[model samples]
Target: MDRSRVTVVIVVLAAALALPFYAGPFWMGLATQIIIFGLLALSVDLLLGHTGLFSLCHASFFAVAAYTTAILQVRYGTPTVFAAPAGVLAGTLLALVFGIAVRTRGVYFILITIALGFIVWGVAYRWSSFTGGDNGVTNVPFPSIGPLAVTSHLQYYYLVLAIVMLCALGYRMLVSSPFGLGLRGIKASESRMRSLGYRTALHLYVAFVLSGALASLAGVLYVYYNRFVNPVTGSFQISVEVALMAIVGGSGTIIGPFIGSGVLLGLRNWVSSFFELHAAVMGVVFIATVLWAPDGLVGLARRLRKRRTGIRKDPA
Candidate 1:
């Protein structure tokens, strides 16, 4: 990373660590939600930003993992150790099956994913016997392992921060690795990548599964934090919203998704207080982003910085 970027990261981390000291419980909780959903947006970007696939079914994997963890923990009294991994496993396996959508491209791929996402949502909504239907599973306990139990929201916030930091670091390494390069190449031109003897479809499939696994992890974090899982958790709107977060924050960069999440979620929280049309506000924000900031907030910042530098160096 550049020196400026490193400095920004450090400042951001320091602020996050100090948030509890100045922010109230509501703000702290909102921060925690932003991080969790940011993880989800990051997962979506693995396909949308890097692999050039627009998937709408990621909520299936996320919801499935959440339900699995919730079911195991609440109904069967499973420990966090077993339940958490099982949740990830279930969601990943679903991703493996849904990865078949990679066979199609463009709008077809989007349509297929939408169909798959609806299937999961339908099951979650109608299958009241197993899934608790629209009510979803509730009374989920905080994650605990042996004696290291998360007892409060503050503790959970710190725990989430620690895990997200590790995830961001690992994600950076993954994107810089050779496989990451291959995905980017595939995104630029799949035909050219194939001409170069790359198994593009298999690569995309793997990316899809990996993305789903990340989304599943986010879901696990969410269920523990929210202490409930509802049908809305697996809804199509979530998939759409997270995708917007990726685009609005800067799709390809690691930090963009989180920034987008903060903007969207924070805006919603603040706007909904007095306005009943908060969703419309989000739509307007998205339209503004598309029309004026196609490359997103991060890109906009870079452009402004370059312009400032240019003015400083201008001979005229």
Candidate 2:
């Protein structure tokens, strides 16, 4: 990375590392949530931002993975090792099936994903016997691997941070790799990419699956942190919210989703305490973001910095 990016990263890391020490339990919990949702938003962006495919069913993969891990750990006495991977695998498998949606583009793809998401949500809601409907699964123990275990929320936060950081690094590498470039090319023009001998459908399908796997990973983190699984976890609203988080935070940028998560979650927590219309407040924020900062906060910041630089270089 360049010097400026390295510096900004160091600063952000320092703040993340120091937050728990300075903040109270509530704030710490909120921070953890932002990180988790950020990962989900990032996954959505893999399709929305990089590949120009807007998927609305990511919460299905997320919920499936979460439910899989929760069911295994709570009902069957499965170890975290087995349970977690099973969760990711289940979600990825769902993604593979859902990958067929990529054959259609634009609004059709969005509608299909919405339908697929509802299927998972309906199953979770109606199939109470297997999914623990309404009450859902509860009292999920913190993950443990023989000698190593997360005994408290703080430790879990650190674990999540480590995992998210590693994922971010890997994502950075992926976006810079040849395959990542190919996705971008497809995003720009499927016809052009096809002319260049790239199997655009295959490319989009692979990206969709990879995106689902990442969303599934986020779900695993969320289930462990929340200690439960429910239909709400896979609801269409969650898919919309996370997608909004990506757009509000600045799609196509690594740090943007996390920042967007922080803004939305923090605002909700603060506003809901005093205002019954907190959902309305969130709506206003989204509207404002769309109107004034279409590219997102990160993009706006970059614009401001460029403007300042230009002013500094001016003869006057």
Candidate 3:
């Protein structure tokens, strides 16, 4: 990474670490939610930003993982060690199935994902016997493995922060590797990539699965933090919201999703307090982003920095 980027990362990490000391419980909770949703947005960007796929069914994987974990723990009394992994596994397997949509492109791919997502939402809403219908699974205990247990929200926040950091580090390596470059190439020109002997379809399929797995991890963390799982957890709106977060925060960058999440969630929290039309406010924000800041907040910052540097170097 460049020195400036590294410095920015350090400052962000320091702020995150110090948040608990200064922020109240409500703010901490909001921060946790932002991180979780940011992770989800990151997963979506794996396809939308890098692979040029816009999938709307990611909530299926996320909801499935959450439902599996909630059901196992609440009804069957499964251990965290087993339930968590099972949740991830279930979501990955679903991703494997949903990845077939990669066979199509453009609007068809988007429609297929939307259909898949609705199927999950329908089942979650109607299958009251197994999924608890619209009520969803509740009273989920904080995650515990052996003697290590999260006893408080503060502790859980730290745990989440640590896990997200590791995920970001791993994601950085993955994006910097050749595979990441290949995905970007495919995004630019799939036909050219295919002509170069790359099995572009298989490449996208793998990325889809990996993205689903990441979203599943986010869902698991969310269920534990929220202490409940509902059909809304797997709603189509969530997929849309996260997609917007990616675009608004600057897609294809590691921190963009998180920044977008913070902006959206924080805005919602603040706006919803007195306004009943907070959703409209979000719409305006998105429209403004598309119209004025097409490349998003990060890109805008970079452009401003470049302009300043150019001015400083000008002889005139």
Candidate 4:
């Protein structure tokens, strides 16, 4: 990372750490969800935005991790430490399994993922005994990492923020590493990268698993925070929302999704509280974001930076 990126991360970490002391319960709860979704968006960014893979079926990977943790903790009496990793493992395996077939590396790849996603979703919603069908797994235990107790929503918010910040940093490092650079080269020209001796397929599989793992981590945190894990948590619509948050907020950058999730989630909560047509309002914002800011909130910030530096260029 360069100096500016370092500066940005430092500032963000500082702010996240400080939020609990300043923000009220309502905002704290909202911020917690925003952080979770932001991590999900960033995972989508890793495979889709950075690697140029158009994946829409990530909900399968997401739901599997979540439900796995729910089953382990709620039914089998697994500890939180085991539950988190078990969830991650479940998600990673799902990614690896589906990825082997769908790693075709383009639009076909997306279709394959969608097919897998539908299948998993069906199992989640239809398997009433294990998943509780629509009710899901309620009252998920609060996570206690070693000595730290993460029970309160506000306390849990900081824990999530810390995890998200750390994961984002790790993601940035992975993208900057040689393996990461190889993925970018593959995206630019897979044929050329293959000719250059890069194992493009293997790189994509690794990225896919990593993305799945990160999304699963977010799923575990989501369950812990809400004290609930429902089949709807892994629903297709929620998958769309995650994609929208990533695309609308900006992906592949550390802060863009956070900014996007923050604004969009805040608006959604506010709108849902008052109106029957909450989706209609959100749809308007989504359409506006796509039309006016295709590159996401981060893209808009980049434009502002360029303008401040006196560079003349058309946004469109």
Candidate 5:
């Protein structure tokens, strides 16, 4: 990374580390949410930005994982260690089945994902006995091990921060790895990649599964934080919103999704306080981002810097 970016990262980290001391409980909760959904948006970008596949059903995996953890803990009295992994497993298993959609592309792929997402939402909304219908599974306790445990939201905030930081680092390494380069190659030209003997289908399928796993992990974090799982958590709207988050944040970059998440969530919280049409406000923001910042906020920043540099070099 460049010096400017490194400086910006250091400043951001310092601010995050100091947030608990200055911000209230509500702000802490919101920050946690931004981190969680940022992970979800990042997962979507694994396919959208890297391999040029747009998936609209990531919320299915998120919901499945959340519901699995909730049900196991609430009904069966399972411990956090077992329930969390089970949730991840359940969602990953679903992803393995849904990976079949990787066979399709373009509009067909989008439609298939939409249908798949709706199926999960339908099951969650209608299957009252198993899923608790709209109410979902509730009373999920904060995650704890044999000795380590979270007693408050502030403590959880630090835990979430640590985990998200770790994920961001790992994700950086993944994107810099050879497999990540292969995904980019496929994105540039699948035919050319295939000509070079790359099994494009298998590559995309594996990415899809890995992306789903990441979404599942986000869901586990969310369920523990929110202490509930609802059909809305798995709804089509959520999938759309997270996709928009990735696009608005600069999908290919590690920090972009989190920045987008913070912007969108913070805007919603502030706007919804007085505006009844907050959803419309969000739509307008998306339209503006698409029109003026096609590559998203990070790209916009780079463009402005380049323009300034060009101006400085010219005779004036």
Candidate 6:
């Protein structure tokens, strides 16, 4: 992380730690949801921003993980340790399998992925025996790792922070590795990468698996934290929110989602206090962002800095 980002994260964490004392249950709960969703949004950015692949079915893995965790705990009586990994594993396996087939060039892959996401959502909605149908699985237990159980809202918030940090760190390492370099290569020129025999499909499969796993982890955490998992968690709403956060925060960079999440979350919260027109506000914000600030907030900041310092233009 850069100096500015490091300082920002420090300040954010400090603020999070103090939230419980000042905020009421509603606000604290909202904060937890924002952080969890933010982590999932970061995963979306990992693929859409960095790899330049539009995988729209991200919520598929996320929902699958939630169902698996809910079933394990509510139906089969599995322990937290086992349930969490199972959720992640379910997501990874799906990503690996789907990524391979959907790694086609052009818009074909995007369509296929969108079709698959709906398929997953339909299953979650129809499968009443396992998923509890439209009601989703409720009373999903809080996980206990090494005898430390997260049973309350405050405890769950901290647990989410720890998990999000790990995901962020892991993503950072991956982006800094040779494989990440290959992704940037593909993003820059897929034909050139294919000429070099880079097996773009396989690389994408791996990226999808990692990305899906991260999203699923967030889903599982969301269910556990709230003790309720709904079908809407698998709905397009979740996917749209994640995509928006990534775009708004400045994708391809980990810090972007974190920053974007905070802004979006804070804005939503502040608006909910005064107006009943929250969705309209979000829609306007989203449209304005795409039209005027396509690079998102961080992108805008960088442009301003360059203009102010008058960074020398490249020699023609």
Query: lDDT tens digits, residues 100-211, model 6?
Result: 7444855886778778788788888888877888888887877888778776878888778887888877888998899988888888887899899999877777877788
Compared with the true structure, all predictions reach lDDT values of 0.94, 0.94, 0.92, 0.81, 0.93, 0.82
Instruction: Please report, as a residue range, the 10-residue window in candidate 1 with the lowest summed lDDT.
Output: 167-176
* TM-score, structure 5 vs. true: 0.98
Better of 4 and 5 by TM-score: 5
Tens digit per residue, CA lDDT, model 1, 191-279: 99999999999999999999999999999999999999988999999999999999999999999999999999999999999999998
lDDT of 5: 0.93
Q: How well does candidate 2 score on lDDT at residue 165?
A: 99
Which one wins on lDDT?
A: 1
> Could you arrange the candidates by lDDT from highest to lowest?
1, 2, 5, 3, 6, 4
Superposed Cα deviation of residue 119, candidate 1 (Å): 0.7
**How far is 312's C-alpha from truth in model 2 (Å)?**
2.2
Q: For every candidate structure, what is the RMSD over all alpha carbons to the true structure, in angstroms?
A: 0.9, 1.1, 1.0, 2.9, 1.0, 3.0
Which pairs in model 1 have colliding backbones? none
lDDT of 2 by residue, 1-316 (tens): 7899789889999999999889999988899999999999999999999999989999999999999999999999999999999999999999999999999999999999999999999999999999999788887889998899999999999999999999999999998899999999998998999999999999899999999999999999999999998999999989988998998888998988998888888889999999999889988987888789988888898899999999999999
What is candidate 2's CA lDDT for residue 200? 90
Give the per-residue lDDT of model 3 (tens digit) for 1-316: 8999899899999999999999999999999999999999999989998998999988888899999999999999999999999998999999998889999999999999999999999999999999999889999999999999989999999999999999988888888898989999999999999999999999999999999999999988888999899999999989888988988899899999999999899999999999999989988987898899878899999999999999999999
lDDT of 4 by residue, 211-270 (tens): 888888888777788778777777776777777788787866767777777888999888
Model 6 ranges with Cα > 4 A deviation: 311-316
- Model 2 has an lDDT value of 0.94
Kindly provide the TM-score of model 4 when superposed on the true structure, using C-alpha atoms: 0.92
Off by over 4 Å in 2: none
